[model samples]
Target: MRHTDLFYLLALQKVEGVGEINAKKLLSHFGTAEAIFAEKSHKLKKIDRIGSLTVERLKDKSVFEKAEAELRFIEKAHIRAIAFTDKDYPEKLRHCPDSPIVLFSNGNIDLTNRRIISIVGTREITAYGRDFCKDLIATLAPLDPVIVSGFAYGVDITAHLAAIENNLQTVAILAHGLNQIYPKMHKKYMSQVMENGGFMTEFWSSSNPIREQFLQRNRIVAGISEATIVIESAEKGGSLVTASMANDYNRDVFAVPGRISDKYSQGCNNLIKTQKANMLTSAADLVYMLNWDLQQPIKPVQKQLFITLEPDEQKVYDFLNSHGKELLDIIALECSVPVFRLSGILLNMELKGVIRPLPGKLFEVI
Candidate 1:
C-alpha cells in the first residue's frame, strides 16, 4: 500500500475510545481513514451506537500525536503495516469477527500458509511438553507448514525454535513493540526468526506488554491457524484459552496426552476426556487426523534432479545429513562453496524437503 494509505489506517487504529471492531466499522462506513477523519463529531454522532460524546472524546490531539510517533517508529524499525482489507493480511483473520483493523509485522513469512499449527501450553511446562514439542516439530519440519506461537517462554518459544531447526517458517505473535524483544533470553533466537520467518502483532510500537493484550493475542494465534496443539498446561492454563478460541473459530484442536500424576498433564487429559481436543501422539497422528498432504512419491525418481547440482550441493546434503544437523557456515566450508551461493543451493534442498532448518543458523538433514 501507499505510504499515505498506511498512515491513514494506522491513524484510525490509534484513535482513542475506538477499538478494532469499531475502527473496522468506521472504515466500512466511510470507505477510507481519510474520509473518517474528515467527518465531524455531529456527523458521526448521528450514527447509531456512535454517540456525540464518544466522537467528541475521540477528537483528542494526543491520539494523532501518538499515531504520528508510531508512524515514525515504524519507519525506524522498517516495520510493515497491514490492514484487514489488504491482500497480504491473512484471509483467515479477515473472516473473524474481532479482527484487527491494522497489524504490525516485522518478518518475511506469508501469514497465509497452506497449513498453520499453533502450539501453546503452560509457562511452567513439563518434561513431556519439551520432548513432545521436539519430536512433533521434527515431524512437522518436513511438512513445509508455518508454525505460529506467542514467543512466550516454554511451549511457545519451543515451537518457534523447533520450526527454525526444521527449516519451516514461524511467526511470533507479539503483545508489544518490534523495538524490544521480550524474555531477553530469547533475543538472539527471535532475531534469527525475524530474518527467517517473522513477528506479527496488533499493538503499536511503545505499547506496554500487558496481561490482557497477551490473552487477547491468543485468539488471533488460534483463529489464524488451521489447528491448535496444546502440549502441556494446567487445567486453567492459557493453552485452554487458545483451544477455546480455536473451537469457537471452528479450527481443529489437538492435545498431547500426559501422565495423570503431573499437574501440567491435567489440561490435556481433561481436554481429551471432554472431547475438547483430539488426542495427538505424534506429527504423524496430526497428519492423519487433518488429512494433510504428504509428499507424493516421485513416480520415477529421475536421476536428473541430482545430476545438475554441480556436485557441491550433493556433498553438502550428504555431509549435513551424514552427521545430521549442521550450521550453514560449516556446510559452506564442507561443500567448499562460497557462502553467497549457498543460498540457492539451500533453497533447492528445502524445496525438495531434503534438509531442515534450525534456530541459530543451523541446518539438519531431513
Candidate 2:
C-alpha cells in the first residue's frame, strides 16, 4: 500500500457503522479509496447502505488517527496489506458478495497459486480422519497443488500439515487478524507455515478472532479454491457452510467417507448419500474427479508370481520383493501351494491399494 493511502484505508475500515458491503459501495462510487476518503458526509451517504449516522462518523479525525496507529502495527509486523483495488488481490475473493475491502496477509506465501483446494472438517477428528490425511497426502504430494484450510484442529490442521510435509505450498485463511495466531497452541505449526507458506485474513490487525468471523473466513476458503474437500463435518457447522459456498460457486466438492456409526463420519456419509459431494476412496479418485493426470508413469507390475511364495502364503509380498518376479510354475515350486490359493491372495493385496494388478495374470508393488 502507498504511504498516503495507508492510514486512510485503515480509517475506512475502522469507521463506525461502515460495514464491509457499504465500504465496497463507497469505493465503487468514488473509483478509489483515496477518493472515498475525500468525500463529504453528504456524498458518502449517497451510497445505498451508507446510513446518515455512518456519514457523520466518517468526519471524525480521531477515527482516522487511531486507524493510522493500526497501520503502524501492520508495518511493524511485516504484513502485506491490500485494498480491493490492488492488482494482486485474489480475484475469486474479490467477486464474493461480501468481499472485504482491506485484507492483511502475514509472511511471504503467494495467495495467487493456481489450483488451490480447501480441505476442512470437524475439530474432533477421528483415526479415520488421520488415515485419510495420510493417504490423501501421499497421493497428491506429487501434484504440488496449493492446499488451503482454516488451520483449526482435526481435519483442518491435518490437511495443511500434510501439504507442508509433502513439500506442497499451503495457506491458512485465519479468522483472526495477522497480529496473532488463534488457539495459540498451533503457534509452532503456524511458524512452519509462514516459513513454507503464509497466513491470511479479511479482518485487520488487532481484531479478535470471534466466532462469526470464521463463517466469513470459510467463504474465502471455498471461493479461493478450485475445489473444497470436506474430510469431516457435522450436519450444522462451518464445514457445511463451506461445502454450500463451493456448490454456489460451481466448484467441485469432494469428501472422504468415514464409518457410518462414527459421528464425525456421519457428515461425510450424509454428504455422499445426498449427492452433495462425490465420494472419494483414494487419491486416484481425486485425480480422476479433478480430471488431472497421474504425475508420471509408476513402474508397472507384471505375471502369476504369487504361487512361488514360500510357506505362509500370505507373506507373498515379502517373497515378491525378495525373489523378484516369478511365473506360476516357479511360485508353485517355491511355496509348494496350489496356484488357485496364491491367486486369491494377490488379488486381495491389489484391492488394498498396496499393489497393482498387471496383464496376463501378473502383479507388482505400486
**What's the residue-level lDDT of 312 in candidate 2?**
48
Q: What is candidate 2's TM-score against the reference? A: 0.77
Candidate that would win on TM-score: 1
TM-score of 1: 0.78
**What tens digits encode model 1's per-residue C-alpha lDDT throughout 190-236?**
66898779999888767778888888899889888889999998979
Runs with alpha carbons beyond 4 Å of true place in candidate 1: 294-366
lDDT of 2 by residue, 84-203 (tens): 778888777777767778788876677564557889999988887787775676566655677889989888888888887888888899998887887788988977788778888878
For residue 146, what is the lDDT in candidate 2? 78
Off by over 4 Å in 2: 294-366
lDDT of 1: 0.79
**Deviation (Å) of 171 in candidate 1:** 0.8
* Alpha carbon RMSD to native, model 1: 10.3
Question: What's the distance in Å from true for residue 200, model 1?
Answer: 1.1
